[model samples]
Target: MPDPELPVITLEELGVLRAVHVRGTDSVEVELTPTYTGCPAIEAMSTDIERVLREHGMRKVSVHTVLSPAWSTDDISAEGRRKLREFGIAPPRVRQASGPKEPVAVELGPTRTSRPVAGPPELAPVPDPVCCPHCGSADTELLSRFSSTACKALRRCLACREPFDHFKEL
Candidate 1:
């Protein structure tokens, strides 16, 4: 089934549909991971899965929400990213590798609060610019941190001057 939020790509391509297993002749089990905790689409997705599977002749369909391996933006497939761009949404950058040797790293380089503190401010790591999916320009500015959906950020391209939603990094 296609992702409800980003209909341009299927749930399989989005990496949300983790696995499918057949317990018996007519019973099937599906594993799904949500993009984030308390994702609003999970219910809809689950219902869709059950209906589709049942229509396909499965007497019983069970969709289990798996949260052990938390979902990330990196879970998106290359094809899914291309579809997102074609759909006029900037895809998120791949931030981490999925391996036991490599772990998710966080760097609190610098921060500014109401008050100042200490020596000269240290520079934080700069993130690669989010390229405009339409104009293919790296000259885009964030208009809002949260767009129509919490998972996306609204931005406008300097070259095209068109406002668009960007799938935010998880």
Candidate 2:
């Protein structure tokens, strides 16, 4: 049971801390999700969690690693978003699926021509899908998919030209 007074955050919201389940007074199970598929922080994080739980008198603490139900920016809570920005990282933008055949451009040839030429509109894509913390610029460009970690991407602000990390979209 979750405490009502305390704010509830998904494991992703906590970043390192995943799920904690209490089986009994002495037995407990913890589920951990890595920042990336090959993240090295897993060892350190697992040790830290173990130490903390042990300190709290969790005797039979078992840490289980889960990879399913992949992590996503949506899984991150508002508080998590705040923390990420504070840590100099941008959150992933929420992208809704557009309707099928959302016409970009439909060009009807010359006034007398009957041929119809349809092409994708040249509308500027969302620069920074997520709002940029630096310079408060939403206009951003994806620098690299691989940042310092696989879970983050290197993004550059078009207005500021300052590069920052963007949390991956799941």
Candidate 3:
């Protein structure tokens, strides 16, 4: 099945097509998970799936959306990432579970006690250094948070001086 957003990548490669259930003859149910909540392409994808199934002579076809176990950038297949990069969109970096290692703390000012600072957990990973899709240069700068699509961001490479879209990690 094709991805409505990125047509070059299939739904399977996008990791949204969860499963296909066939109930007896002439009945089929397709399970899908959206890349993000309230994704604009979800309804289009469902419609496409049903149309394809009907064209294949299925009398009854139902598309179900599953939201549990929210989708992540990790869900994108290796092939998908490769395709995305080849299409001039930088693929998301694998999210790090923990922040960078911190240096050992030292007590100063005759105070032996030091209190740890607490903050809310980060909702998303810090943006990784982006490489230019045109010249493969690591010296790229983010131009804007939003790109042509909601999931991407605008960036420019210092080497090639070319602007490109980066697929932001969820």
Candidate 1 lDDT tens digits, 49-85: 9999999899989999999688888889999999999
**lDDT of each prediction vs. the true structure?**
0.86, 0.61, 0.81
Instruction: Specify the poorest-scoring 10-residue window by lDDT in model 2.
Output: 1-10
* lDDT of candidate model 3 versus the reference: 0.81
Span of 10 residues, lowest total lDDT, candidate 1 = 107-116
Clashing pairs in 3: none
lDDT by residue for model 2 (1-170), tens: 11111124334564445678998887788888765577676666667667778888889878877776544445566777776676667866544343332222333234322223344445423232555767768777766767876667788888888888877665
- Residue 53 of model 1: what lDDT? 93
lDDT of 2: 0.61
CA lDDT of 34 in candidate 2?
A: 67
